[model samples]
Target: MEDRELLDQLFSGGDASASAWRAFLQKYSNLFLKIIWQFEKDRDEVMEKYVSVCSRLMGNDFAVLRKFPKELGLKSSDFPSWLVAVVRNISVDLHRHSQGRRRYPKALLRLDPIDRKIFDLYYWQGYSLEEIGHQLDLRKNGKGTDVNESFARILRMLTRYAPRERKATFPTSVPFNENMFVPDEEEPRVDVALFDKWLEGLPAEHRLVVRMRFWEDMSAVRIARILKIVPQHRVYAILQKSLQKLRTHVERNMASN
Candidate 1:
């Protein structure tokens, strides 16, 4: 059956359609597993959290699920993409709660949840604005969403005063890793190997540019120069496509592993 038809059936209060949704979830169960795998916690905790996120979405109103495609401007062909976005958003929230409680200096401990995440992404992850933009798939002309607005918020938070920075009590990198960069404190470890395996079947150019830019750290200018191709502003689109593929890839790999 078509997605819109299935959605119409679901939203119209067909109770038996619950199984249809269940089948949809089952079809994409790997996506949920990938989000949980990102947490990289204990196996049991991982399973529990994975199930929790799924249960939340499963019980979510059918109207809510139906709204996603429309709200995101996703096409019927883009159903999987929309599905993965929902899964990732849930996973990020789980990581936020987990990080907030980790052992830290009293000053650092006082930072708000969002601030901690921004700080983590900036200092710990070492992601540049462009890279962060690429990860979130932000683009110029406000492609779907405004890039400038999101980063402006991020910069404001990053520069926001934290008590720890004020106190000079922030631990140095070596000791900091022990305290702040704890693996379990973040999301589960992504299975890069399994993710790569899923992408092995994708088109070569798609896979190559992605591997070059992200995994190999080649800049778009460099990628264009290397590939002897004209550079366009749509590097983000290329990267976004690759990452989306990996996102789904990660989702599938997480479940299997």
Candidate 2:
């Protein structure tokens, strides 16, 4: 069926299980799958996100389809671009949620500036030895040490200070009005584990900016240069987004548990 016909059937408020819906998905499934694969390379991960995108599109009586501007009289050719945009957004959300479940070791927090940058670029950003070497000016046959040796040393340091699981207890006592305004008697310890958990929830670029700024103590100008971001303002914007995600996650966890 043509895109307009399928869209007309969808918005006609008729039965959703009609052939129009099936035809729509059949025609667009490949496009959506391609966009999903762009975000996730693994076969399993790609399939999972594709299924999620389908579910979302089909949910609420085809709510997403209903959002389309039918008045504009969209053509069949326009459908692919529209569908790609939708699928890409869904894939990004899925990727972010998946990343959120991971937690970096607290040992990463203690690394010195250079080692930390090497580890973050290599592991967190998935940069290769050569790429990292180029970015950090650690190119072999130059003034600096070999990238491979530096990376191995960072790995050894991480292993040496590997994080150990520990349980923490917080007071449950409720303070009255006067003491409520005052600080707790005991100093509140920073929960590196919890912080790491929140950090993982951030999008890849956002996490990179946050780590560079706070963990690596690099200026935004330096971060923009290292990350190859065009403008310094983008680094600030990413930091804002990252902090907002972390704050929201903390609030949700507090409410849930």
List clashing residue pairs in candidate 1: 38-187, 38-188, 39-187, 39-188, 40-188, 40-189
Q: What would the TM-scores of all predictions be?
A: 0.40, 0.37
Candidate 2 yields a Cα-based lDDT of: 0.63
lDDT of 1 by residue, 37-100 (tens): 8765677877877877766675767544766656755678776677778777777777687564
Model 1, residue 22: distance off in Å is 2.1
lDDT of each: 0.54, 0.63
Per-residue C-alpha lDDT of model 2 across residues 52-130, encoded as one tens digit per residue:
9988987898888776656377666777677777778778888885454333334454454455566555544446678
**Candidate whose TM-score is highest:** 1
| Candidate RMSDs in order | 20.0, 17.3
Give the CA lDDT, 0 to 100, for residue 12 in model 2.
70
